[model samples]
Target: MSIRTVLLHAAPDSGFNDRLAFAVALARQSGAAIKGLYTLYPAGVPRVGRALSIYVNELVREAKEKEGGLKAQFEQATAAAGLAASWETIEGEVASSLREAVAFADITVVSETPYGTVDDQLAATLPEHLAMACNGPVAVVPTGKPVPARIGKVLIAWKPSREAGHAVRFALPVLAAADEVEVFTVEEGDTTTADSGAKLAAWLATHGVNAKHRHVAEGNAGHAITNEVQKFGADLLVMGAYSRSRFAEMVLGGVTASLLVDPPVALLIAH
Candidate 1:
């Protein structure tokens, strides 16, 4: 129920600093330990010639140098924040390494994937993949945006499913601390009861979170959720990820896909 350890993915990229700062702030707020995890690109072997081998070695060296710099930045930031932290480097594919690292963490903080071509598979899908594999919760910070000073208002995309219920429970610590929380559900027909959203709000009330329930008209689930986020001025949006399979989501375009593609705010997702 409490955040005791926060796992942050550290990379030598544009959004790394913002993600690290956000993770550090969350750790400071919850008095949790921060674990900085970096995945090093696996060194490749050259079978052609000595020159190619030398080039490969050079690439590996440059990667290590960059990793060292990133580690230093992470350490300095955590120190400045006065939070207990640790760092580790994994040698393998980024997503796989992150999935393994999330096992020991209560929550994982990652940057939103840059919108573009899917040339970089890991970067494009890391957050979603982590949400599925982490078994806890993954907090995704939007790329190029600094963490908000306060997460006072939160929007919960309620869908009356085991996954959504898990997400709400996993985010209880944050919800309990928020000044205001709204639980919104989009009705696709009579498939969902009229009081479904209110039921979630009532459950949250038991945990001391006085949440307002809103029922939205049937439409695109993703757009409806985003509209609610904008209307409520929510600093954080909590929801379940991949109610469908990843392949299905990728092709069919579900709420998970929409949020990952263009997150309206910081998102806390669980699967």
Candidate 2:
């Protein structure tokens, strides 16, 4: 699908300046518009609607101030990138609104935070919950670095599975722009030991990406992907965020958890 609009989710504590920049970069390239959305976290209990009304007003007031400041900074950054990005504020759960935004746009852009960051608590777009929504491909921009306009290599954590396939599909734009696209999978003992690597490569070729299949017989799947990502000097790593359970890592622990901060490469996640 063509990208005519992009939804960039923002909140009071979003620490993803780099992600905002990346979305602006992509928007400029695609002649698309960027909408920066901020959601206010309601105060007090849901059951006591009346009791929370006054406190809710206070929360909304503070949120408005935060949004004003954030909107200014966001506009300045996007303007510097020569793209038209605008802001809007909403009141609701961050994750639900983000999903709605994704459904309404061509693609979704988010900046992932460390598993336990304050922003994660506010927006809860932390990789796991995000991957679970399954609304659209999400570009999880890494913090602490500048977003690159172009990438040299692309890493696809593949396994001939839905998640892997989705990752490839989600990364179509970035993959097409890279010099090299590599599909890599690691053995996990029991199931998925087939020659699916070649199959994944073929899938990539159909999408105009000449991906090379590479299989690693040993090492942790996430670790292997990271090592190869670094080895290839890949600018982007695309992989499915397998699970988004509160108990699972996407929100709390596993692979998504490990890659939250200073990942080997910027991750583009979809479920």
Candidate 3:
């Protein structure tokens, strides 16, 4: 499906501009409108005493002030790019707010790590949380990097699972627009894996994606995929997100968990 509405997390952190850049590029490619979501967390204050209440109120005031600047920046950027844009402000938990906003978006954009101060531990894994919580695709931009102006080469991390299939289907729009697309799979001496990769590539061809299939025998799937992303110099990496149970993935340390922590490039993922 073509992207029509892009939901972007607008904040005052370092990744805000990068995330916006990525969102603008994607929206431009698909002729989509952008919606900037600015979230406030006045609920995080504890009702311990009056001193803390006053401190929390001051912090909220400062955050609100920052929101004004961020809104201006968003408008200027989107307007300069000639894209239709809108603004929003929500007061609550960031994850909960995004959960509702993503429902109306074709794709949601966010930073791979926390969007606030470095000590904001609650949001350290916001991207992963949204990836699992949302029903649609999430495009996560790398933190503190210059986002690519266009998605030229896309690398798809393939696996024979429903989540991977969903990711491929959700990423069809970007894949079709990419100049080069590769379906890369890491196998352990499994011939069937190679055959499946070829079939997936052929099927993608029917959807107007010229994808090349590649398979390698590697035991560490997470490391292998990240290394391939760097080797290929890919602009974007499309892959399935959270193929395992959250508790199991947390304890076992799967690929989705590792990559979401520190993505080497822009990532488009779905559950």
lDDT of candidates 1 onward, in order: 0.82, 0.71, 0.86
Better of 1 and 2 by lDDT: 1
Query: What is candidate 2's lDDT per residue for 1-271, written digit by digit as tens?
Result: 5577878877665455777777777787667889998888641225257767787677678877878777887889778877767787878756766766777777777776655654555444445566777577777777666567766677887766677677777678767766899888787773564478778788668878888888888777767777898787777788776644436663455565676555766787777
Best by lDDT: 3
Superpose all Cα atoms of candidate 1 onto the true structure and report the RMSD in Å to 1 decimal: 3.2
Greater-TM-score candidate between 2 and 3: 3
lDDT comparing candidate 2 with the true structure:
0.71
Residue lDDT tens for model 3, 84-111: 9999998765778898999999999998
Sorted on TM-score, highest at the top, how do the candidates line up? 3, 1, 2
TM-score of each: 0.88, 0.83, 0.92
Per-prediction backbone clash count: 0, 3, 0
- Candidate 1 vs candidate 3, lDDT winner: 3
